[model samples]
Target: MGEPFYITTAISYPNGKPHIGHAYEAIAADVIARFQRAMGRDVRFQTGTDEHGLKMMQKARDLGITPKQLCDGMSSYFIAMCDNLDVSYDVFIRTTEERHHTASQELWRRLEANGDLYLDRYEGWYSVRDEAFYDESELVAGEGGDKLSPQGTPVEWTVEESWFFRLSKYAEPLLKLYAEQPDFIQPDGRRNEVLRFVEGGLRDLSVSRTSFDWGVKVPGSDGHVMYVWVDALTNYITGLGFPDETGDFANYWPANIHLIGKDIVRFHTVYWPAILMSAGLALPRQVFGHGFLLNRGQKESKSLGNVTDPLELAERFGVDPLRYFLMREVAFGQDGSYSPEAIVTRCNAELANSYGNLVQRVLSMIFKNMDGTLETFSSAEADDVLLATVFAACRDELPREFAAMNFSGGIDAWMRGVFACNAYVDEQAPWTLRKTDPDRMRAVLLTLFMAIRDLTIAIAPVVPTSASKVLDQLGIPADERSYAALTGADWYMARVATGEKLGAPVPAFPRLELPEDAA
Candidate 1:
């Protein structure tokens, strides 16, 4: 086992089906988790649906279904999305689960014990769509003089008896935390935004709601349920078995990162850390608020009729190609757009034509010319230079960029390695060597064989299925496919000793055509 690396996605609110935005966040988090494991870390990845909130209750009423029934049916769609898209999440928690309720109440009890909770009356702007309370200063005037939350969701004035957390008391402490740990909130823009918000001032946060009972009950308070954010945020610790304060809670308590959308940055970075501090727990190492995925150039919405169902997109395009296009096309921590033409052009040129063709041509030639027998061969200066270039990209550049969460940049480095191998194939002209100098040809082919292995392993985290197919043809064992395997010296010779013959190669990433409707 390696050092623990725990990461989570903002649990999806189940008022609607899974969208492209949800899929984008889950895929990014999964890539990070896989990348960490490849770097020799024990990783825990969690994602699920946030099932309790006032919006859910109203939606259930409109459907004439019980809230649990609505949640049960809706959350399954999210689970299926994860399964279909190959999101390797370890836990899929729902706030309706009994364990989650227990964890939420336990957190409340801890806050109460710390004197952070107090009875109060809340009369302010509440956004049902966002499940958030907003201050008068934060509301914006919409078309026709309607008051809206900063997110542009309609706001309603609500009056209720509530319990508030003394968030004001921790404003200075949170500021000090940001100062001491400059990387506590990521991407400088988000961190600076939070800094400005906190510098403006803080107010006591309403932690319990008296208007609805669709949430975790307030401990010993007969008629109130917790604010949805409190219950939803607690899902992070709930998955780790908190309150017991032992086992996983003891080991992975303070998560490495909470990957969330920019729309809810305040909830995760500001409110979450404050809540953790009030409960006397260590804060998460970082909160990263990532940008949205747009359809073409505009944000998707029901009114726009541009909402994309991610599963449908996955079905239209192969999963690996879709995954590749996302990490390759999008600049991490910033907004990116995708359309059918973009997906086809990017995947076809890069995955199908460039890297995939390199794998197919190299392996097919080895099978046809060398009788599929891999053997030790003498290398020339060109062979050494090619290997060194590929090695630097895989072992040094890609890992460095990925560790900093610059995913597009890391893939760019990996593509450079791929391009180098293709260029080597052209320069060596191994086919000509087969007729003129068979021994030199064998050496050239073997050098390419080694370079292909490194490229495959470096990229497996992003496109796992296609990489596995390539590795299978290369006779690389499952256990030896991690990044750690790239540096080991004896694997190739050991494989040659096995006398395993390479099989006929298949196209791992066949070129895709654009759908007619999308065209």
Candidate 2:
């Protein structure tokens, strides 16, 4: 409705190779971006790596490489993964990039100018693994009575001279903002958590770290660098051209949505907005903290050796199916498990049996009987009913489902059309009609063709390759392949060129074979 829709996935920490969890988030965000674009909205999708963090520095040290080298190498892998996943991101912003550092420093300067930043001595429990400072109340007793962070990462007491942001001063203002915009932080539970945290009390946030030298250097400060969370959080604005308010920045600022994991809801909902308010900037419209992807029964992590490699999965199973499973298997804002069998089951049931079979059977019937041309289907009553239903699904039902981010529900509605068409073909018995009533057979085949064309367009955002294959089979020209065209009957009248051979139906989703003992 407005100029364009802008969405972003939280820039991932490139401490290690990306796993299925990372791929899941990217695919989810990409689906939303693609759907909005298909609805004729200009869409800007942003995703990238967060390279400046304590964990990243530690990872660089472990790899015996410089931080830049490690980040560059790992960031490349993430970019390749996005490509493999068919994620149409507009820009990839790395925290180590000059643009990002410049933006981060500018944000700091704005906060400093507003008198929100001050030098202070910090003494608290810090976790390098978590890149977070924990209060004593948050630490739990570990084995041998050692204190552990809530994340189960070890913690140690640290004292340093750090710059602190006046987060405590903005607590009341943030609570008021949250009350004014109840939908600002999504999924109710995440919002409640943030509200409760703010209600309890707010503490001054350490914005700079004197210990980490691998981060953005604080403006006018030689020994201190901006903290990783503060640096990484600035990327949303930086990617849009924050400080200068340039054309691109002005065009996409006040991002429509920020898609992040549930683990970091605090930084996004609380700290990030507080920083923005301190700098006299508008907060993003929505911050949706989607849940994690669990492996074996626990959260996926490097130490557990349970992390699923996204590239390997893409290579084994096609990218579309993997992308489809990620969105289809779980509700967008809930934690879900990943098993090879679950992926295979969804592909076989939804893609192969439901969608793919319907298209193949319809096209095969048309090719054999009418030579793939339907001149006058509008006159037939049965044909009109099927066409009406398919159009309703594509034009009304699917769009509503997608608007609510119910991707699986949207695909299910589209699948209902597929199933109904299949049943209609069987009941009409086109093969019998071809001999007894040639005119009836033409109507039936035409109805099937229209249904196939509409369903393919509806599911294109989820499975582009397979949808394109359906378009090729229908002889629909590239120009006619759009949501608007599919919803109207005008596109159906376009003459199908005779003798154009349809491609052989290769299995869109082949069954996955697993060893008996593997599960």
- Say which candidate scores most in TM-score: 1
* After superposition, candidate 2 runs with Cα above 4 Å error: 495-507, 510-518
Residue 20 in model 2: shift from native, Å? Answer: 0.6
Model 1 reaches what TM-score against the true structure? 0.99
Residues 1-519, candidate 2: write the lDDT tens digits.
436788999998887788888898899898888788878777889999999877888888888999999999999989999998889899999988898999999999999999999999999999887788888988999888999998788998999999999999989998998999998998889999999999989999998888879899999988999989999999998888878896777788889899999988998999999999999898899999988888755887668867789888877767888787777778778888777777778887878777777777777777676665557554477777888888888878888898777777887788788778878888999889889998878778777877888888888888877677768766778777766676555665554434354544445545555546447
Steric overlap count per candidate: 0, 0
Q: Could you tell me which residue pairs clash in candidate 2?
A: none
Give one digit per residue, the lDDT tens place, for model 1 in 415-442: 9999999999999999999999999999
Question: What's each prediction's TM-score?
Answer: 0.99, 0.95
Cα miss at 412, model 1 (Å)? Answer: 0.4
Query: Highest lDDT: which candidate?
Result: 1
Q: By how many angstroms RMSD does model 2 differ from the true structure?
A: 2.1
